[model samples]
Target: MSIDFGLIFARMPEILAAFWVTVWIWIVSNVLAVFLGFGVATLRRYGPLWLDLLLRLLVEIIRGTPFLVQLFLLYFGGPFIGLSLDPIPAGLLGMTVYSTAYYSEIFRAGYNAIPVGHIEAAECVGLTRGQIIRRILVPEMTMLVLPQCVNMAILMMKETAILSIITVPELTLVVGAIGSQQYAFVEAMLLLALFYWFLVELSGFLGRIAEARLSKFRFAHS
Candidate 1:
């Protein structure tokens, strides 16, 4: 069968609009995930035992389940619990919860990697716990975990496609609708792949640049 590249060209506007929607969700979710994950990691390290156990259980539950199931529960099952949410909100909530679980572990590993002596030294300097975390631990941990965070960020971006199943109007959903209406599944699938490829590549490129600059900053400071 012959391919019609013109269909892709004609759908460029819709594709671009959906692409931005995906990116926007990704940005908002991951930003919240990063900070919330760090907080979860920190609490697990230093908070009360009950709180730690509760968070640990939560993290494991989130990590253990499939994201699609989680999204479905949030979007479809929420109404049963008197907590209904619209598609975009449900999608964002699901993405944030899912990403936060993994990001918490990534940050937990970063916390472990820091030398105990560094914390001891900060203590000797009369730095408060919050001060040390903000001024020292956060900066060091960010540098150490930048690569892992980038990988997670890309993973989250791809997972945004799953939100299309909940009818979020993201790139994948729009493309799928086009494919269904036009009977051009092959062309639609190819175009969808191309858009995702560009997004992933762009994320990786930006991640590498950030890593390089951070590496230089660490080296110079050392």
Candidate 2:
């Protein structure tokens, strides 16, 4: 039997919605992750020991757990607590928290890449702590942060696949549903894989653009 391209086209809208869901998660989670990660990274670098330890402990806990387990716990277990969530929100929240912890280390490394001498010189010039961080450390670390931040954004896009486990109707979940309903397993999966590959490529392309922009200024990390 010949393949029905027209049938696939007819179902395109559903597929497109799934694709949008995935993109939406990526956008929301990346925004959240950047803020959460930056805050966590700052706490590690500038906050007191007690706050640092608490933040580090949270990071460690997240890093040690598998994403799938975390999703299950949040989706299935959260209702028992006061924090109930719908599929989409729950899935995005899981991805946000997961990305936040991992991205925190990357951002922290960017800050750490700045030289101690630069910070000391800022202090000697009578700049306050906020001034030193804003003018010297952060500016110097921009190049370092750019690559890892983009990479983390791309990684989060891929991680959105796990949301399918919770029936969020994102890309993977839609593909699986359509495949089963249509009995076109191979065809559906191939299309889904192609979609994901395109998404990743697009993200990588944007990252390269950002890297080029950041590379204009040479920050000596050594």
Candidate 3:
């Protein structure tokens, strides 16, 4: 049977709307996860031993499990524990928590990449710890960590498709609905792939811009 690409393009408005839903979820979830991961790593790196152990255990547990299971537990299992959430919020919460574990490791690696001599030099220059972190460490750590963080962000964007399983009204779910309704599974699926590809390309473009801007700081300093 010949395919009618025209029918799929007819639904472009709905598809684009669904795409925005996916984008918003990804943006909010990644923002929260990245910052929270940094906070977790910083606390674990500098906090008391007991706190470090506790945070380490939490990260380990999250990293050890599949995100699908966590999403199910958070959305389907929450009602049993007297916590209820709508599908979108539950999905966002699950994604943020799960991604935070991996983001924390990326951040930890960035921190470790810093040279001891740099910190010592800042100390020798009479910079306070806060000033050293604000003026010295954060800038360098961002440069070191950005590529890995971008990779994770792209991964998270793809993973947002899974939120469709919980009926989050994201791009995949909308596409699935249209496919079933129109009996055009092949066309719908192709559109789905194309949509995701666009998102991935956009992410790569933005990441390149960020990396380029970060590079300028180094040249300016030099």
Candidate 4:
């Protein structure tokens, strides 16, 4: 069959709007994940044993489930549970919940990866626990965690597709609607694929710059 570049290009405006929504959802989710993950990691690393256990359980539950199911609960079941969130907000909330679980795991792993001697050195130098983690662990772990966190952020951006099931009108939703209307399934899908590829590659590019800047700590891993 012949290609229809015009058809695909014409539909891009709708897709562009969807792209913004997708970006916003992922950005807001990652912003929340940063704070939530730091707190979760700190609690798991140095807080009471009970709080650590609770965060571990919570993280596992969030990660073990599908994003679609989580979106449904927030978007559809929210009002039933006394949370009548706007559709966009509900989708954003779901993205935060889903991303936070993985972010927590990334940070927890980074925290654990710190060498025992590193902490001991800090302590020997008279640093408090908080000071040690802040001054030593965080500086080292940033090199370790940034790459994993960037990968997770890319995944979260792609997961915006699930928001469509909840009527959030992200990239996938717009593509689907156009594909149905134009009967240009292949073209529409190709555009969607291109968009996702761009998003992933963009994230990787940014991550590489961060990795290079943080590569000083690769010595730690070595």
Candidate 5:
């Protein structure tokens, strides 16, 4: 059977609107995940034993749960706890919480890879803790972890597609609605796939650029 470009083009406005929602949700949740993950990892790495254990427990609990279950708990369960959130904010919160758990693991791995001896050496040279972190730790970890972080970002972007399950009206929901209403499942789904494909390609291209720039020190050493 021939494909119908006309049907797809006719629905472009709604599709584009939904796509933009997906884009923004991905951006917001990713930013939150990266920062929160780093913060939690740092605290767990250097804070007291109690704090470390607590963070570890939290991470494990989050990781053990399914993403959809978490989303439902936040979106549907919020009202029961007197924390009524709109679909978008609830979805954002769920995504942020879920991604943070994984990003924290990535960060923890990066942090652990940096030798304590290097930090000690910096300290012996009379460098302040803050100076040591800024000059030594940050750059080294960025180089070691950029690739994994890029992969996590891509994964987080794909996870945003699931936000549609909560009526967040992202790409999947929009396309699915159009398909159901117009009996154009093939065309609607084809366009949806193309939209996600373009995003994945764009993200991969930019990630490669970032990885190359950030890992220049490694390249130079080799």
Candidate 6:
């Protein structure tokens, strides 16, 4: 069958609009996830044992389930529990919760990788726990785990397509609608792939820049 490049070009506006939605959701979700994950990791490390166990259990539950199922439960099953949410909110909530679990683990690993002597030295120097975390631990841990975090961000970007299943009007959903309406399945699919490819490539490029800058900062501080 012949491909129709014109059809893809014609739908560029809609595709780009949807692409922006995906980007917005991904950014918001991952930002919240990272901060919340860091808090979770910190608590697990230094908080009381019961709280750590509870957070650990929750993390494992989220990580163990499929994201799609999580989304469905939030958007569809939520009404039964008086917790209804609109599509975008549900998608955002689901994505944040799902990513927080993995991000917590990544930060947890970063915490473990820090030398104990560093903390001891900070203690000897009279830096409060909060001061040490802000002045030293956060920066060091960020440098150590940044590459992994970038990988996770890229994976999360791709997973935004799954939100389309919940009718979130993201890139994949818009493209699928176009395909269905115009019987241009191949063109639609190709365009969808192209949009995602661009997003993933752009994310990788930015991630590399971030890693390089963070590396320089880490060394300068060292």
Per-residue lDDT for 105-200 in model 5, tens only?
999998888888888889999999779878988788878888998898998888888889999989999888988777778888888888788899
RMSD of 1: 1.7
Off by over 4 Å in 6: 219-222
List TM-scores for all candidates, in order. 0.96, 0.94, 0.93, 0.92, 0.93, 0.95
Q: lDDT tens string, model 4, 1-222?
A: 766757767877787888888888879889998779887888887889999899899899998888888887787888998999987988888888778788888998998888888788788889998788778988888877888888888887778888888888898888888887887778888878887898789889988898888787674442
Clashing pairs in 3: none
Residue 42 of model 6 has an lDDT of 96
Q: Taking the tens digit of each residue's C-alpha lDDT, what string does model 2 give over 1-222?
A: 555545455688899899899988889898998888988999888889999999999999999999999999999999999889999999988999999999899888888778889899899999999898889877777777888888888888888888999999999998878877787766777777888899899989989987887687866545
- Relative to the true structure, how large is the alpha-carbon lDDT of every model? 0.92, 0.86, 0.89, 0.83, 0.88, 0.92
* Candidate 5 C-alpha error for residue 113, in Å: 0.7
TM-score of 3: 0.93
Off by over 4 Å in 3: 219-222
Give a tens-digit lDDT track for model 1, residues 135-180: 8888888899999999999999999999999999999999888887
Off by over 4 Å in 5: 219-222
In model 1, the Cα lDDT at residue 193 comes to 93
Better of 3 and 6 by lDDT: 6
